[model samples]
Target: MTASKLYILDTNVLLHDPKCLYEFKEQDIAIPMTVLEELDDIKDRKKNVSSEARHAIRAIDHILSGASTSAQITKGVPIKQNALNGVDTRLGKLSIFPDHELTMRQGFLPNDHNKDNLIINCALHLQATNPHREIILVTKDINMRLKALGAGLLKVEDYRTDQLVSDIELLPAGHYQMEGNFWEHVTDVKSYQEGKYTFHQIDRSILPNTYPAEYIYDESDGFAARVISVDEETITLQDLNHERIMQQNCWGIEPINIQQAFAMQAVLDPSIDLAILNGAAGSGKTLVALACALEMVIEDKQFNKIIVTRSTPPVAEDIGFLPGTEEEKMTPWLSAIHDNLEAMHEQDERPQSSVKYAIEKANIQFKSLNFIRGRSIQDALVLIDEAQNLTPSQLKTIITRCGKGSKMICLGNLAQIDSNYLTPLTSGLTYIVERFKDYPGAANVHLEGIFRSELAEYAEEHL
Candidate 1:
């Protein structure tokens, strides 16, 4: 028998990651009519709103067909997928919505500055009618959850279907240990540089992100040093021979971990124009790069714009066709882009309005690589988020978009690729690293830490 549960979803959550729907499958979902309205508002967005966005609309429409209707609009119908529709919930059962003649018009109405409030009210309406059912408000925005908790709503979780792993997969506090004499060197620096040396620790495999790894110098001089390896120890790092190191803390992120510090060394190095940062889900790769880029933008006055760009693959998304003005179609896909901006400003204590001001001034632009052919952004801080989903060819196009005096940061988790012709190992993140291994102007860093939350890190690993 199907149990009773009522769920209300926020629009930001859906637009950020469309897979939010399945997380509440078979539950009595009160689609905050306002969310539908918001979705309708952006139905013509071309860039980030993939055909999947339109497909999501059609998918919702299909679910709407079977739901039972009450006399008023406050009713929710049990949703089941149509076999022909291919939107199966897998645990589907029949449901109905209140068929009131008012069509929910008389119910709690939404207003300006009231989107989040209105969604919660819709969930409350469902809770009132369902009598003995669990009421949940599923949202990715932390503030929304806080407000919902203040309003007395319980039983909410993020949309986990698209999540790479679960809470149980997180490496616990004690998973990594560094013992004495972890590395036995087979060659000296001369031979090692010649690719004749291989280092190994008997009966022990080095873990990711753990450093200060002790390695014995097998040379006639006989000394000790730290070793960092990438991809089966084929490529190893003995040290960062930087001329100077900068002192700055990443905002809303921890002190630059060893991996990130190494990455920063390259980012700050005048030699490196292209660098790639890859890591697990909670890694500080993106945040660190973001902080450094913003640092240059604010303090150094180095660039005119921080042109942030990312790509999303379409799967029947068909955003209904993009006839509207640019900003109209661009708003839906740039939420995360804005989230990062907000966080940066939020931490810096600069007027929170700086982000919006920068965007309005064209100092911060969110672009899609879809048709970015001849446009060159010179002297800018360009950040290409989700570089993992981009093909090497596509990545090339984005990089070539950079102009003189511009620095581009590519951040993504190789474990999570969404583009075509790419896998974890073959993604652009890895491709960039392997190709630029010896380039003086290129560096690579892989972050491995949980800045989001303990639970989030756990889920990143376990789920």
Candidate 2:
């Protein structure tokens, strides 16, 4: 019988997903000592990944806690079965490899004090010694995968346990567009009125892919409706007037397109707890979100305050050294929010005064993502900008901080992801959009077209 494959992990893989320890089902996992050393060096750093490194270390320690001897640890430790997460049987063993003591071979890549070379050397040594087992090296770094393969490792793979979609193109667009009259497809429909709103109960077959809170629009017939509820047999859609939605104004800002109108409608609705907006860089995501937030806080009195935070790049660690209050320090990262605010009030006779009045009236607060971990925000409208830079775990940490009577709006542009560890397919924005599609209290809109400028639109398409 063929033996189970031995999979080796890299440092970035653990930092990418700390819970990855149990994700590999029934396969033996080997972590080189270099990875531990790297994690040790990083666990004490002030970066956002330090917490992830510590979590990875704790998971490793938990798995190897029962071993009494170095010999037993070197050989392998039986992974404890976790039935809660669906690990029903003890079929995998985890071991640590001492890569520093690996003997050099004639064709092996020179270590030269490089950490990646050390990891590659360990894989080469393991492959040379264990001829029967198929060894695979898993890392999130593309360069590390190339180096491992170049050093003669048989199989190298990426850590894809958190990936929800194989391709970004397969992701849902948050709204459906029908070419003709939407009623043409409905064979059975029962229209009714409930509290100044019209709802249609149609056979489920008419819109099999529709989900709650997703919009269905027909440009030809100028009809739009939102899927309010769905059952196995029928779907209930709340009818919306296209012209009325387009004419809706929030803080003097009206929707430029139907997609933006959909976003504004979702954000303004008090029943929706979460709204995700994704589009090109200049697609008015930030503008629309901020406009709705201001209206909710200052005009409608729905929310008491507006809390804005975003995932800053790890390299910008000088936020602590910057001389100012928390809001001032966050000003650099949250400049986009201010820019949108200024744009909203640009036509005012006293633009700067209007901006200041708006800020004070709304009780707007800028916060750092690192500082928002433990606090629960109540009666607030939270706007998270540049969300594509975050991992799924990081996004979850912020989302859970929303207490009762608080709403969250996440705005991201997948084309401009700045995180080295993320791609459009693995982005947290993409993850949430897919995970929360069917949720009744959440809505997602992928705003189309760049309304920022004609030049910006041309660059988005051509450049």
**Each candidate's lDDT (Cα)?**
0.56, 0.88
* Model 2 spans with C-alpha error above 4 angstroms: 1-3, 83-88, 314-320
lDDT of 2 by residue, 105-162 (tens): 7767886989988888888888888998999999888898998888789999998888
RMSD of each: 13.4, 2.1
Kindly provide the TM-score of model 1 when superposed on the true structure, using C-alpha atoms: 0.47
Best by lDDT: 2
Error of 1 at 199 (Å): 24
- For candidate 1, the per-residue lDDT at 164 reads 32
TM-score of each: 0.47, 0.95
lDDT of 1: 0.56
